[model samples]
Target: MRIMLDIGHPKDVNVFKNVILSLQEMGHTVKIFVRAKESTKRMLDDAGFEYEVCPYYKSMAGKAFGILANDLRLYMIARKFKPDVFVSPGSPYSAHVSSLMRKPHLAFSDTEIAGLVTMLTLPFTDKIYTSTSFYLDLGPKQERFKGYYELAYLHPKYFKPNKSVLDKYGLEEGYILLRLSALSSHHDLHASGFDFETEDELRDYISSLEKYGRVIISSEKLDWDTIKEYQLDLDPDDLHDIINYASICLSEGATMASEAAVLGIPSIYVSNTERGYLNELETEYDLVYNIPDRGEALEKTISFLQNKNTKDEWQSKKVVMLNHNIDVCNFIIDRIINIDKRGL
Candidate 1:
């Protein structure tokens, strides 16, 4: 089988990397198409995977117009690859191009608030797979799975933390990991996180976290000199290893927050918006805390750091989560094989 996978974000690469390798091990040819984004291509290169970089527009207007432009580019690629199936994390380009090529497009999506992307992709996609905790219902084509995209790579069966990564970065255990999102995605246009009125205010807030332990800032946009000392400069592939050993994770990005939670690290997701998976992790599992307000989020972070037993409790909760959830990489591989056999 020839499988075509499209990566729309760096997180998409993590979600599908295991699946891609598993397909290839099973003697199937896997072709990857990725959008040009921060660290997306670099991570693929580090993983030693052959991929084609698709054109992406940074501006909002360009993104709107690039749909047709990208669709044409992918159409050309698919014409030559002639894949048996097209898969992505709900990409309209893949959906449209696969539909035009008369190939089935399988979308595994978790973001219910990406209204525009959902509208453009679902109508053309043959099947839509999402976590069981996903909020939206995409009619009959939607299928529920008992795991998250994070587990596809972060699951114990696939990933093990390497303490050497900590040494490489000169980081010690119990460091607080702070992740800042660019908040420039189409879905994040109205969302906000870490509401500091000024750069000095943000720097002061980060300095306060130093009392708990070392504060490592992994930011997408903020690069002012005030926070330069705290900013992390490491390979994208080493991030999960760092997350696995962190005392706590305070993140504006949903993907990193969920990743930390799955790794048994207590995560505080600070964003105006909500995700069904994050809600489940907080309510059902008590592994994650979703606090939209910046003040409340910081309060919770301080409380979590002060509590010495937090990591032990989170580890126990993580055991429960792992027992309940399926191995997402295996699940995806099985689904792909079955879908191909059934021609669905």
Candidate 2:
């Protein structure tokens, strides 16, 4: 089988990389199509993932024209790649173009179906895979829901990471990992406004945090001038391992917050928005806590660093989470082999 995977951003690239690899390992020829951001293309090249550039630019901030152009680009990629099936983690482009094509198209999504990309892509998806059935808003299409995103298609078993890369960044033992992410991509400016605020608050916050452990900042966007001014350090590989080994994991970003929790690190999520899978994990598992502002975030983070109750509880839950881990890749691969491509 031939598969084409479309991912629009660097974060999406990270999320979908394992799935693309898993699909290829399952004996399906996989070709990736994405809009490169910063070093995304180079990273994919280094990892030896085959991909092509999509023509659409990512700037319009969720505008109609942006989505339409992406749709056209998806069609172009579909024609160029001519894969038997098209898969996207959540690119809206697939929805518009795949609907017009004859082959099967599927999407693996965790965000709400009503979400802009999902909404646009819903009409085209032959199958939609999600972490939970909570995405029924897309209507009763053929769907598969799993217990966790890590299990959905990518798990540590399949993700080959080299943590020794941290030594290059001078990351030693006893460092606090701070992952910075903004809500701008989600079109929630209010929630991501924390991204634009002065580094004084972050510097002060880190100052308070460092008393508990050494502080290292892992920023998604590395502006050397500002990073140097803020005295932040960047180590791509160890940033994650550090999160896995940290005394604490702090982020305004949703993905890393959940990632920290999954890695068994106590996570402090600073976000104005209260809705998301992280909130669900916070309620169900004790590992994640939400703080509305930097001051409150700092307090909760300090308290968490001092206490191991949540980590202990999460450790207990982690064993069970693993036991319940459904190998979604197996299911997806099975479906692709047996699914009747005629209807969906």
Candidate 3:
């Protein structure tokens, strides 16, 4: 069978990398279409997958046009590739293009709060896979799975932490991972992330974290002219390895917060929008804290770090989470190979 997979973000690459490789190993041909997200193309290149570039525009004004243009380009590629199926991490372009091409479109998603993406993609998609804890109703097309999309890659069966990441980055002692995301995506239209009133506020925030140990900042938008020394410049794949060994993880990204939680690391997520996965991580697992502002975020960070048993507590919670979840990569591979079994 010939499969067409679309990667819209760096996280989508991680979500589907195992599935793409396993399908190829099983004598199936896979074609990848990727958007130029941060380090997305780089990761695909590193993994040795030859893919076609789908052009993307950065400005909000050109977004709708970009989506339409990409959809048309993808439609043209689908016609030439003659794929048996189409798959993505809930991309509207893939869903619309596959529907027009009369191919089965399987969308894997966990962001129930992304109403705009869901509304545009679901009607055209053949199947929508989501975690069992997902909050919103996705109608009859929804297929509930036991684990998150992140588990497809982060699970022990698929990923092993490379401790050499510490030696490679010269990170020997305790350190904190700070993530500042550019919350300017279509889904994040009204959302705010890690906002500060001034440069002084931002500098003060970073300074406060110094008491715990070293602060490594990973930003999607900030240009960090004053603190370039603290900015992280590692590969996306290596970042997870660093997350595994971090003293604490603080991010404006909901996805990274969950990634840190699943790896037995305590994460402080500062975002205006709440997600189902983060809620589960916080309430059920007690591994993540969702703070909407810098003041409360710093307060929680200090309280969390001050507790000497925080790591042990988070590790116990992670075991409970793992025991309840399925091997997501295995489930994904099986679904792709025997999609008819799901009555699609």
Candidate 4:
């Protein structure tokens, strides 16, 4: 079987990496198409996967125009590859091109708030897969799965925490990991996080975290001289290892927050927007705290930091979560094979 996978976000690389390897091991030809977004190329290169880089637009006007431009680019690529099916994390370009080629397009989506992308992509998609916790119902073509996209790579069967990553970065066991996302994506147009008035205020807030433990900051678009010393300077591939050993994760990004939760680390997600998976992790499993208000989120963070049994309690919660969910990479591979065999 010839399968074509499209990567629209940096996280998509991790989501598809294990699936790609498993498919190739099973003697299937796999081709990857990635957008020129932050860290997407670097991750693909480090993983040693051969992929083609597609064009992407950063500005709103460019993004509107990019729909047609990227659709044409992917259409040309699909024409040459002649894939059996197209798969992505709700990528409209793949959905549009696959439809034009008369091939089935399967999309896996978790963000219920990305209305524009869903509007453009789902109509062209043959099947749209989402986590069972997802809020919206996409009619008959939607399929609900029992696990998260993070589990495709971060499941215990695939990932093991390496304590060596801590020593390499001179980090102690209980260091706090802080992720400050730019929140510049299309879906994040109206979203907000970490309501600091200025860079100095943000720096001051980070400094306060050091009183509890060492703080390592990872920012997507940080250029402030005040927080330069605390900025994380490690390879992107080793991020999970860092997250695995952190005392707690404070992230403005939903993906990183959920990653920490799955690893059994207590996470505080500070965002106005909510994802159903994060809500489940917070309300059902008690592994994550999804607080929209910055003050409330900080209070929760300090509470977790001061508690001695938080980590152990989170690990117990993680076991329950694992028991309820499937190994997502294996699920994706098996589903793709079945889709091919059934000619669906």
TM-score of each: 0.98, 0.85, 0.97, 0.98
Local distance difference test, each candidate: 0.90, 0.64, 0.85, 0.89
TM-score, cand. 2: 0.85
TM-score of 4: 0.98
Taking the tens digit of each residue's C-alpha lDDT, what string does model 3 give over 203-322? 888899998888988778656663466786788779789889998999998888989999999898999898888888788888899888878988899888899998899889999999
Alpha carbon lDDT of residue 116, candidate 2? 61
Model 4 per-residue lDDT tens digits across residues 243-344: 999999999999999999999999999999989999988888888888888778777888889999998899999999999998889878877878957556
Q: Model 3 off-target regions past 4 Å? A: none
Worst 10 residues of 4 by lDDT: 221-230
Model 2 residue 165 CA deviation in Å: 3.8
**Backbone clashes in model 3, listed as residue pairs:** none
Model 1 is weakest, by summed lDDT over 10 consecutive residues, at 221-230
Q: lDDT score of model 3?
A: 0.85
Could you give the C-alpha RMSD of every candidate to the true structure, in order shown?
A: 1.1, 3.1, 1.3, 1.1
By lDDT, the best candidate is: 1
Q: Residue 193 in model 4: shift from native, Å? A: 0.3
By how many angstroms RMSD does model 4 differ from the true structure?
1.1
Candidate that beats the other on lDDT, 2 or 4, i.e. the better one: 4
lDDT of 2 by residue, 216-292 (tens): 76666555444455444543433456666567777877767777776666777877765455665677656578776
lDDT of 3 at 37: 67
Model 2 stretches astray by more than 4 angstroms: 55-58, 61-63, 133-136, 142-144, 152-154, 159-163, 193-196, 221-226, 229-238, 308-313, 341-343
